[model samples]
Target chain A: MNMKLETIETDVLVIGAGPAGSTAAKHAAMGGAEVLLVDKKSEIGTPKRCAEGVSKNGLEKLGIKPSHRWIAAEMDRVRLVSPSGIDVWLNQENVHLPETGYNLERKVFDKHMAMDAARAGSQIMVKTLAKELTLKDDYVLVKAESMGNHIEIKSKIVIGADGPESRVGRWAGLKSTSKPKNMESGVQFEMVGVELEDTRAVEFYFGSVAPGGYAWIFPKGDDIANVGLGIINSMTSKNAYHHLLDFVRECKATQKAVSVEFNVGGIPVGGPLNEFVTDNVMLVGDAAGQVNPLTGGGIISGMQAGLIAGEVAANAINEGNCSLENLKEYETRWVEENSLSFQKYLKAKEYLLSLSNEELDSIARAFQGSDFERIGPMELLGKLVKVSPKAMVKLGKIF
Target chain B: MIISEFCMYCGECAGVCPRNLIEVGENTLKFGQKPCKNCQICIQVCPVSALEVEG
Candidate 1:
């Protein structure tokens, strides 16, 4: 490939305008820096792949109001089903927020966010792809392609908001790879004509049905719902779609239903990245492994990271110091705020994935009738240890 | 350049544009004529209306 033939300049350049990139761009621009945000898709939110679940608290932090056009439904409760189909209902009374979750129209949500960043004065470029990053003498060179033409942008600072399969971080000299076993392949479908109550609840099914992972039903509305499942990559003996199909067939509502849409994607279960920053670049959101280890939710964490990266980048730019030492502040802020939760969740995830069907059932039985307190990762791990100390002892090895 | 609300801040257009004429901000997206050659390539592939050619 010919080296980039076109050249540009910016105070800050952010890649992969997903949740993280948008957040970074928004905050960075608000901080008074000239920012450029870009994405490769023809539409901001087309080819939807996420289950579109975000915590209520997460949305508020971003100053985003839940619009009906973007919100499929409100989730106030969660039902955890064991291997034998024993249901444990966790009500709103147990959680801090009354409305705990939002079922999102990701396409709309993503697009609106990008627009918000634009409204904040950041320039956004769509349908452009970042091919690589070159470290110039004092700045970074972003090589890209647009409409079959080459382009390059020089910037003092760069943010990588790219997704799990990010090449930006790798190209920027950061270790951004994930192990196969630490990844989960997922399949989701929007089914219409299904008869279901219009309750704001999310459901989880664990057992051989989902194997290594679980299945979920997030109601979009009274008649439409997102029925999806994720299985660990190690359990790829069977296709993810086949598992989703089997779950759909088993669902009483899905019988005689027509499919309105289908989506397939992968979730990184590898926990957070070991490092999220380097000299001139920072990684945020999925690229930084900000998704929850238990539920595979990243909107909240991604937004959180974006907020921090934005502030840090803006500060660095204002100070006229854009170096690895300065950018490391973003890393510190993120780790100080979320490292504990992330580490604990990562441990719990490892333990959960290694449990047998019988073990899962036993643990569920132990937790039955218990008050559904909001349990942190360590608390959840402690419960597992209390239930089976031997298993907990073995967990130490896996972690 | 004109940016539509559909832009997602991917930064690809700014990264690859010949003139580098894009800047995405919080709550708003904007662009400046910072050496833009008006190659019109950015207008061709913006995944959303976030980018457009200016006369």
Candidate 2:
């Protein structure tokens, strides 16, 4: 009887405070809807669990202005090192498109993003954990605990941006049905003192060293970098952390680097989930598994989807119908813009994992001789067709 | 019943294991000695073909 309980109401309740959640919260509030964003952590983005690489164009796609403060390194080229260490440097010069992006210090980036949401008229709460969800007349009720007190929040709509381990989506019956193959087990180390040959080119080493995955050296600065790898295929029994350590030991370029910080996390290596929205709810970011299958990068796609989700959720609130019928627009629109590319990445992943070490070396050779550029999944198919029309034909049918 | 090199350690199998018998070890996955009831849930959840079904 002595326990205190508090209650509040808002038009939208956004969960999680990563880039996706904060972006959604900002957009929803910008649309004149009362928004509340919550994160269980005391801080928004600490204990980073990412490789921290985002494409330059991807930021533009999400409409996020490049902030110099959090942008630790600006990549100029990406080198794909083959099994034989044949480096295929991909840049605007050869790839016909810019693949360069920033290596972010996510801790600072996420805090400022959520603060922006606050400035846009949304209330933000940290260290608040949503415990349960109940659907009631015209709204959803969220039961949460914060600072040793129980709180009840009512909202017309809920957006789950709660990362890979999102409970809100599960509470809304959108349980993750992803298979292990559709997820990437990733580990990274923030290292310094590596004599990086190309400070501007992020290096990806591919071979038996990282079976079923590729190890990367994303330079954070001239002598410091984030070295990580994601694995879902191959024949290794070692965990990804040990695999990364082993990779560092073996790579001539990474040997001298000393680890200063370590991070581990899982990535949804699948396309968007089968169901992203149901009655009165939508999911964004890793919660909806909106990451590239091949690259294991979600920040770009997650932020992009957040923009659409926030707009759709806000529109539904304005339209006086927060039902699944109205909210399903988020799903349709996101899929329209992103689904094909996601599916193609999945296909490309299958093709990449199927190739042997010798084939990878050959791929390096093929890229060297090619004049074609902009090697997205579709472009990858065109390149594959030149050598293996049969494989391309099979992949074409699926994609 | 061994985890091969292909695992990225997503730990989906551990999460889905009904008996909660899976443990994450350094660089590898370990299963408990409890006799599996043949639910096949772990097999169903594994994304890659890393699980060995038999000797």
- Assess each model's interface with DockQ, reporting 2 decimals per model: 0.03, 0.09
Docking model 1 quality class: incorrect
Q: Candidate 1: what lDDT?
A: 0.74
Error of 2 at A252 (Å): 1.5
* Candidate 2 CA-lDDT value: 0.77
Candidate 2: deviation at residue A341, Å?
1.4
- Show the lowest summed lDDT stretch of 10 residues, model 1 chain A: A91-100
TM-score per model over all chains? 0.81, 0.84
> What is the lDDT, from 0 to 100, of the residue A54 in candidate 1?
82
lDDT per residue for candidate 2 within A1-399, as digits (tens), equals 766568989999998889999989989888888899998777788767788888778888777788987898888787888888877777645562222578888888888889888998989988787767888878999998776578999999999887765556766777655556665667888999887878887888887767777888889887989898877633567667678878888888777888998776767776788998989889998879898887778887888878888888789888999999999988898899888788877887777777788878877887764444545767777777776555675588663
Number of the top DockQ candidate:
2
Task: Name the best candidate (by lDDT).
Answer: 2
The deviation in Å at residue A123 for candidate 1 is 0.5
